[model samples]
Target chain A: MADKLLITSSPHIRAAKTVRSIMLDVVIALVPASVAAVVFFGVKAFGVLAASTISAVLAEYLYEKAVKRPVTVGDLSAVVTGLLLGLTLPPAVPLYVPVVGSAFAIVVAKQVFGGLGTNFVNPALAGRAFVLAAWPLHVTSAWLNPLTMDAATGATPLHAFKGGQAAGSLVDLLIGNRLGSLGETSAIAILLGGAYLLMRGVIDYRIPVAYLGTLGLGVFIFGKPGALFQGDPLRGILLGGAMLGAFFMATDYVTSPVTPKGRTYMGIGAGLITLLIRYWGDYPEGVTYAILLMNLATPLIDKFVVPRYYGYAHDVAARRKANRAGGELS
Target chain B: MQFISILLAGVLTSNFIFMQYLGLCAFVGLSEQFETAIGMSGAVIFVMTFASTVAAAFEQFILVPFGLEYLRTIAYILVIAAFVQLVEIFLKKTAPSLYKALGIYLPLITTNCAVLGAAMLNVKNQYGILWGTVNGLAGALGWSLAIVIFAGIRERWKFMNIPEVLKGFPLALISTGLMSLGFLGFSGLFKTILK
Candidate 1:
């Protein structure tokens, strides 16, 4: 005989498809990048990871407790936030930086806006944004090169572009030997990570393809930078965390658009922002802000871009007439 | 008297949600309803105060002296996070009804930027442990006060007719800006206090 039935909500969908499971998928998706992080940033990547993950988990735990609520630290969302925050930040950022970033991500962006799905912006991105604003020098100043850091540092491909390093080779940018943020350096690793996520169904092609395509198209014609479409389209995708953001972060299901056209618009908007920032704005690589600004517009996009359910939109006259043809419902 | 500075600084001069704009998501998202907003604010204050004290002590005693300051941020975070979890468990087990009231709101606290902000500010300001605790407590209270006030305004806004363009986030952001500017009026008081 079946075990005594435990009753709950209609549909009885297994709650097993939980935030924990999704976060695990994200972790698995990030494995390649984590390995790349180790290869490039050395043991320091581990330090950043450990600090971020631990702080995130702990903060999540304590937060659930003090309010006399159920403990949710075990869900590993905090760990995910911590890890992502760490990945976004420079390797040399102070240890507490990740801790603080993780805490902000989980508590401020994720928890306060209503736990889990309710957050308006991606928590990890928000956390990094806060740190970038508060501690700009700490976050931006420590631009350690992969194999080394010195005169080589002021050599960000974008820097070279802006400062007349436009002649800088695409090969250096792709392999990530140039000066930049830790995990963002290796184009190859980020691309591999994106491919893995795409394969695992962690993301769809709309955001990445749209964002990358739009940015590439935008910069190819207008601005002066290293390797526009004229040189190597692939290099532009690899130089920064563009692939990572396009595939994983910007495409976060909860924080991103739902409908096909809406996500396309989302990608277009993000791409425009990235191009604008990279070409004209102070920062050479503009993945972070691009993703963030798009995140803010997600709800707006959703309002105008609801998916067509069967023949609903096509027979809109019939549906609206049925609901409100005779009498006002509201 | 020094404690008074801590209070004013947290509440006005460097207010958590408004002036510093730390936990903006909750400030905007939760303020749509007053009761829930107040409850959340209360949780933030309680957690922020304790977390600050714990973090400062850990830094001053454990991380700093050992020349492991590089690890202080992570360590402090772990301590604060773990403490939040432990507290959640104890409260849930010992006080079920109270836990239910705070159940949903509790998890929100773990990731609240205001809490982390208070702890970080305590360090940045170079406050001793006692002062740090005071600062954290005051920061949370200040955030609570700010959120409650904003929540009231938003509730009233629900009834008031608004322009189509400035109805939702735009209006809320504008309101927050006004509040932030209003708080700006208090910055001088810190100078006065220091003088």
Candidate 2:
């Protein structure tokens, strides 16, 4: 009898999941936020998104063709990069900026680093940080208010926070009815996007919730209460890029730690760094820098946070050595 | 003389990579391997120099004149992205071997805030087109210098016995912190020179 034989050393049933499919899911998840950006920023948003996507794809495609590598640009990771890059920029950015950001996102950060998975950091954030550092006036200069381009342009929430006013009403912030980066204003919209991601299992909640909760706790604990208790920690949580960073940036698969314990620590670190920067550092918004800093910590976190085998002695050799040394000293 | 100052300021004192800690993703990420390190640096040098020149012109002649100065970030991003693509293509066709090594790392340059930051600084500092190009080159050189130094340190790092936790990036960060502390010495140079 020809019996059905089990043939597997490990992973008896390999999940039918590919990077290509995951990226597509992410694309689907981002659609709501993309639509919101377009609605808020107008046709300019669409143009920026298109330019960024096309340029990222084209850059990766041509880079692959030149190198004679199998083109992975079809995976739509370039599109993801383009979208993330677009969301990071101010909506009023010129038509060309997204396209350029797209190229940088794909070619230099992604392609040069041995393509998508091998990249050490989030390509989108890396690109954003690079341009923001290189062209401060450009990144900081052009911001579009929701649905209003001509009347009142450059009043990002952080700018207002720096100016010492009640930075924003909770409602305005929640609804994305305030001035900020292209896609970062609305706590509600970002939370919606985040929820979609969670539902899709594209990411886990540990990183985001931990990062956000810690930020809220740290801010409230460190900051003075207004008239009520703890100075409205929710405000600290809602304002800035807390939502964006928690949901999007901190969850970056490439740059974040692998082990659960490491992820927890990373979230804690992200929170502390973010609070430190937002409260005292020069920048009013600290999510980008905080996330980048934590990304730098992921490899180390993984190294130390390795899982232990069940029922095995914890550092048995070390314990033996210590006992021997103790006996010798006596 | 003013142009020289712009160049100097962009390169030494107000550098995008090391001093200001901008575009650190590439600096920290690519510093591990020398080949990609050099390639990334080359891309930065070319893009920075060219982008600065074009951005200066665009800001002065186009955006400022057209009253679309608000679009600087978007405009610069687009221009820089397109330019990087062009350079990638040219490098591929002219230098396939170099292209092969640098291929995967190119797309990440798009979101690099340092490139955009420099372009914006050019306008903020009221630099002319000529001055912008110089600043760009200087900034690029500064970036390359930082990466080269970092690469050297990281190369040595491969041999040294390091704690498991601090082996890869943690140690790298500690080293970067030390290097940054060292850069503090040069800050005085700018102060005296400018003064």
Candidate 3:
């Protein structure tokens, strides 16, 4: 006999990758956008970023310590969430805003459920949502002009566009030369980070593709003020937080649907809701709430949209045939 | 249109669970199973309707008559506690299965803030008995809709690969927040309609 076979459970094939490494890749991918934000908004952006990331990590460490759970700061998910939250804020937010938001993200959003992988929604987004509700004026009215770093008080590009006014030029919009959320203004930087994630195999492609495609289609059909098929689809796709959310937030593995079909539906549903809010609702931007809504639906999507197990089709067919024969006899 | 507006505001726009954040204990704790949620909701609807009617009648007839307007809280609690006792005893004798399924939750409804909130809100809104009862029924319906939908979602959440920390109540709270975001869409619906 072949020398005693070494049998173990499945998963014989394994990679050297770990959660720490994957989270590191995400952090690395986010760097370009953070850099872009710093470049555009100057030192204020850096302050917000540091405050958020530090408070997020601190919140996680402190919570775990107090609760006697093992500290998870080493994994760096909180850091990523903090960085993402920082990036979403207006560059000129009061420093305490990021701190409060980070605490909310880690303590309330992440650690309260279980700690890390158990969180059902994106912590940063939940934090943002909370503070947004708590202080709507600060969240909505704190936009700053890029490069100039002046407190520019005006509606964002999406808002202006919604009101039938033209926004920035395509180049300006693409290159972080617009007034919007800190990380969301630079389409080029977001694309760079998104592309890196896609190439690194850190994220599934179905979600971003389905999300952007549906959003583009939706805007093309219904984005214009009065006419169908006359809307600026490129503008719709390139604007405010769509790129950031589709690539970064919606792709958070813990909160997203696992199956390919389910992920696709998640993306499309988010995109549809985003366009619905952007077009017909009061909000000028809808990406945050859209992704949050889809995150809520992820479990439902996974439950219903499971991929067929290898032998399930045959089993189903056999059962159906047996039932048909029984019916004929009856 | 006015009645429809009231119905919409109660059921969707100013939803008791999502917007007003009423009855959250039952919404969060008992919303784990769809059947359990339905049972809890049915019991709430029964309790809230009757409680609001009785509370309204008491406030309108007795409390406000003398100088005991400040006794609303005490009187309301007594009324709710008595009504819940009647429900518990009646269910235990007539519908033992439901009584068992409800278990402690039947009596727990006595402390449910939504019941008290509905009664107080009816008083605050100063509606007559008919509208007071309608508001009570509608508020309960809204709570039922929210908890039942959340229960269905939580059932699916069981099979998901949730992280450790966000597994239970924290995750439930976050999910509630997201559902509230969805309901936030209805904020201006009645504003535009009734304008």
TM-score of 3: 0.75
Write the residue-wise lDDT of candidate 1 on B4-60 in tens digits: 877877886688876788888888889888789867876787778888988989889
CA shift at A217, candidate 3, in angstroms? 3.6
Per candidate, chain B TM-score? 0.91, 0.87, 0.91
lDDT of 1 by residue, A34-83 (tens): 77776777777788888988988887878767555556665566777777
TM-score of each: 0.58, 0.59, 0.75
Candidate 1: Cα lDDT at A26: 78
lDDT by residue (A1-330, candidate 2, tens digit) is 111221242332121124556678778767776777788778877777777777778888898887766666656777788787888777777766677667766765556545665444567776676666556666766767677754345466665553445777788777777666667777777888889889988777899988988988886676552332345577778767778778887887766876566778888888987776666554556777777667655555654465454565556543344334322221
Candidate 3 CAPRI grade: incorrect
DockQ of each: 0.02, 0.03, 0.20
Error of 2 at B100 (Å): 42
- The C-alpha stretches of model 2 lying farther than 4 A from their native spots are A1-17, A151-154, A162-164, A222-229, A313-330, B1-17, B20-195
Least lDDT summed over 10 consecutive residues: which range in candidate 1 chain A? A321-330
lDDT of 3 by residue, B1-195 (tens): 766766777886789999998999879989888788888988888889888898888887888888698888998999999988988899899999978877567787988999999999888888768788888888988898888768866774564556676567877877787679656754655364363
